[model samples]
Target chain A: MTERVRVKTMMPPGHVRTPAYLRGKVGVIERELGGFSNPEQLAYGLPAEERPLYRVRFTMEEVWGAAAETPTDTVDAEIFGHWLERL
Target chain B: MPHDHPSHSHEGMSPSGHPYRADNDTALTYWQRMEIAVRELLVEKGAVTPEEVARQIDTMDARSPANGAAVVARAWVDPDFKARLLQDASAASREMGFDIGPLRLIAVENTESVHNLIVCTLCSCYPRNLLGLPPDWYKTRAYRSRAVIEPRAVLREFGVELPDHVQVRVHDSTADMRYVVLPARPAGTEGLDEAELAALVTRDSMIGTGLPRTP
Candidate 1:
């Protein structure tokens, strides 16, 4: 049960799972969805290195800033371990 | 020299809304035609059988929102079933004779305090086995772009207004896992039977776009 982490803003080319909006954003670990093959590597027909994936929860305010209508609104995204760093 | 091919004909709109002008003007783009050619070559090589392909298509076509409605109606009446559904959605759905196939299914409950919404930003990935094909808007760039960023406004557009105290949780089905929202049974419908309850469960409710019919 990992607590809090930040999505790393890795601007890699080609297929990537991490959405652009979540990059460099801080979020809480809602659930650990176990491990999955790194999609970034798999997209290139390379052997994938399985990494831990977590369902991270981010507040609407954190994501949308002042544009957020509801401050309590939350968003959850499944992010791989390689893209996350401990907050 | 130009020749008219008997097999090819100018046709109506394709499934993706592409116009088939004429045989010379292919219905599909060059890349799409190339993709089909490659697929046919693979099939010719016995990588995958045509029968298997047809069967898969049949499975997809057979699915509808009614399957999801049945599960939600049962959960509304049976607390034990609801517990099982929340605990292990895939196994519980299988128990009800619904084939979830290989994807992981997660049922999120919408209580008084929390609301659950689902989206697939990368693509229009959904629980097609239970909910049929996703609506066209779900695949549009507007939805995929704004869902995670402004869920409250999006829900409002769907006429789903929640109190400020209640938290809205937008679940992005980014990976292999799919999600379904187990909406709270509407009030004043306690006397209705299971079949009636099932009738109230709309396709949008399961997708968190709207709520079950109000009694």
Candidate 2:
């Protein structure tokens, strides 16, 4: 089964890679890119830990609802493992 | 001989025919001053030499959309290369002798039914190693916010009106990876050679904003 995940909805103010529009949205993992240094920690000049990154694909309807120009169309974003909650 | 006033050459255009910006003549901005200070500090600290900085700038200037166009043209002509590109874009580009450094690239194909668009919502994370610098419009807040929400409208603004059946997949370059769209080969160009095919590839075509020129 394809792994489903939801983007975390936390709105803390800081350097974050996850976009605000994707917060609270659900999507399936499109692919798993290898581990990369976490930018959130790097932004503060802190020692950053490596985090797994995954490209998550969400339907336009899921992201924008009725406002979506084409509901079946999709949006893909690279999200860090920390920001994703497996569903 | 010393001139009293500045000499006019090429009617204010560079040898490449592009208008030269009066960057040096203008008063240094805050950011420019900061850059100079930091560069001087780095040189003083022996972190890097001025020659090294100049060489790095030359390397960056040498990279342009033409490099990407060559890659796309090769992919269009060779199915094996195209498969490899779709599987591992960075490796494939390196095979073609492009110095992409450590850029993680993903080549998304534009087919009869699917089209791909790239945007960096957090910042302008682009395939700069392959395609040179990102355009000014790409960094605008308007393009960043609207790309994911209303991609079709944005495509229309770029003179691309897709049919209803075509799927628009917008890739938000939010994290480590960068994306480039592999535009479909135009019809009636089967007779063209690799260089000719490459000529048809435009910067916007690779960015998914426009289609390749028809031969």
Top-TM-score candidate index: 2
Interface RMSD of 1: 1.3
Number of the top DockQ candidate? 2
The per-residue C-alpha lDDT of model 1 at residue B188 equals 96
Mark the 10 consecutive residues where model 1 chain B has the least summed lDDT.
B1-10
Grade the docking of candidate 2: high
Candidate 1: regions farther than 4 A off: B1-26
The most accurate candidate by lDDT is 2
DockQ of each: 0.69, 0.84
DockQ for model 2? 0.84
Per-candidate fnat, comma-separated: 0.76, 0.96
lDDT of 1 by residue, B1-215 (tens): 13334565535656544565566664788999898898799899999888888888899888889999999999999999999999878888888999878768889999999899989998888988778888899888888777777777888999998888888899888876789999999999989999899999998899898999976
